[model samples]
Target: MRFSLLLMVCALCSVSQAALTFILGAHENVCFGVFTDQPRTSISYYFAVQSGGAFDVDYTIKNPRGEVIVTEDKQRQGDFIINADIAGEYELCFSNSMSTYAEKVIDFEIKVENDKNDFKANMPDQPNAKPKAHIENMGKTVDKIDQKLDELLRAIQYYKTRNNRNQATVKSTESRIYYFSIFEVLLMVGMAGLQITVVQLFFKGSRKQLV
Candidate 1:
């Protein structure tokens, strides 16, 4: 029983996922690392800037051999998946160097998925064990269900990030509109006052000339 429980724990650890939130200062760069021991593994990442500096940032993904796998500039959100070709530490980086004063609120996720074929091959031979085969099939079904649940969670996070970005945009637009309207009203009032003053001076000059 203990061995079975340990196997379960190890299996769970093999499927890794993380959701992280961080504040990036203006003109700052942050990097994260993920290590894998096998090639052909899938690395998935998603990121969104929730607020500040146009909700945009720059990102880069580097492989174990220091080769660039992916790079994007001035992006607000993204989802990416890449296959690891070598077994080592991979670096993922985010940069806010384009922003001079705005600090960014960043939300991101990283997930590492192993090859399914390897998992299937690792199962012991059970040619004469019907009940064990059935249980193994059930376990696979449960894993599929868990994957679906992870997808749902990711979708929810994506929507939440989008909502926050939209709200911030709306608030910024409203503020600009309010300030512009005030400026327009003040300009119109000043023009009217200037016109009235000019008319009064004209009439005074005309009266003096007639006298």
Candidate 2:
């Protein structure tokens, strides 16, 4: 199991390293192109809005023919795998146009998995290949472990994004409270001064009438 896991990790490191974190400005759009030379390749896409106004973004996936594969509006995060059966460039785009002033911090990953180096492909063609079944079983186990790891990572990212957005909200609330307290204090002081002035004017008028 350990050996299989290691192999899986080693095989995936290059594609996993393509993950990116960046800021998407307000009213701006960003697109990334991924080209596949072979058909029936698996493409995985994942993204989260780590922090920003509403913690949401609009996204679109388009194929080489300019046809939309998927489109979403105001989504906080998504994970999707699509088969790119047509050999060409696929476009993934993120748009913050709905946000007039708030910018977004986005974390996203795109992975392309091809079957050219599949373990099954390298197996011997003999009808009674002794190690074929063992190898296939090992591969299946490794795949299951890999899928679990992906789910765990996605959960972690989701929590992290929520934490960041919550912290931002808390800080904003604290600031508003601070400024409001100052305004309240100023208003109280002004009211007290006005009351004192009114009392003094009333007493002065009463004394003049008595004289």
lDDT of 2 by residue, 47-155 (tens): 9998888989999999989999999999999989988888878888999999999999999887777663553465468876657678778878988998799889888
Candidate 1 minimal-lDDT segment of 10 residues:
1-10
Candidates' RMSD to native: 6.2, 6.8
Using TM-score as the measure, the top candidate is: 1
- TM-score of every model? 0.85, 0.83
Task: State the lDDT of candidate 1 residue by residue for 1-211, as single tens digits.
Answer: 0000011113335566677788989989988888777777788888888888788999998887899989989998988888876877788888999999999999988888777667766778767766767877987999899979978987898899889988988999999999999999999999999999999999999999999
Total backbone clashes of model 2? 0
Error of 1 at 54 (Å): 1.9
Relative to the unseen true structure, what is the C-alpha lDDT of residue 200 in candidate 1, on a scale of 0 to 100? Answer: 100
Q: Local distance difference test, per candidate?
A: 0.81, 0.80
User: Total clashes, candidate 1?
Assistant: 0
TM-score of 1: 0.85
Model 1 score (lDDT): 0.81
